[model samples]
Target: MRLASLSLRYKILDFLYKVYPEAVEELTIIHVFYEYHTVDDIKKHLNYLVDKGYIEQKEICLRLGTKKTTNIYKITSKGIDLMQGIIQDKAIPIPEDE
Candidate 1:
């Protein structure tokens, strides 16, 4: 993992650790924490985490008489290991521009 990934991973793990089982919007995460990250970038990183088996996404439907759906993210034990420095990281990277 690069520093950029590590940073985002840390932030996300911290967030999910603080609010497990509760859904949070990607926009809300960008607005509140990763101010410099775009939704696309965040989504890409999340996809990476998913591919790496560090987190899981739950697609839920709303019951407002509509077909609306929401994507809620949750961290896995592997992700917690990485966040806690149990997983080795690779080269360092910088924060990207939105």
Candidate 2:
């Protein structure tokens, strides 16, 4: 899929790709804000990535006493390949001077 057309999805995938190795430990509420526009937007974007096979979702228990469930996402190999292709293709536009 075209990265520009899938801008939001790509952003989510990029975040997942960056955090895949330490996803369980590094991801946090604050990180979402630093990386994305909003929580609901990120959620919707991640859902699209999940549907497209770019990301895998897992439910992890964050607390022992209550077994609080948290959603953790990781990028697939296919996602990395796609991201590399997009980067190589250089499909993103450079802004023009106003």
Best candidate per TM-score, number? 1
Q: Give residue 23's error in model 1 in angstroms.
A: 4.7
- Stretches of candidate 1 off by over 4 Å are 1-6, 21-27, 91-98
lDDT of 2 by residue, 1-98 (tens): 44444566655566667776655322562375445356665566667766877677788788887867888777887677776664332332222230
Residue 34's C-alpha lDDT in candidate 1?
57
The per-candidate count of clashes, in order, stands at 0, 0
Model 2: lDDT to the true structure: 0.60
**Cα lDDT of all candidates, in order?**
0.65, 0.60
Expressed as tens digits, the lDDT of each residue in 1-98 for candidate 1 is 45665677556666775676565665566666557666776787777767777778777775677898877778788766665667744521223341
Residue 21's lDDT in candidate 1: 55
Which candidate has the highest lDDT of all? 1
Where does candidate 1 clash, by residue pair? none
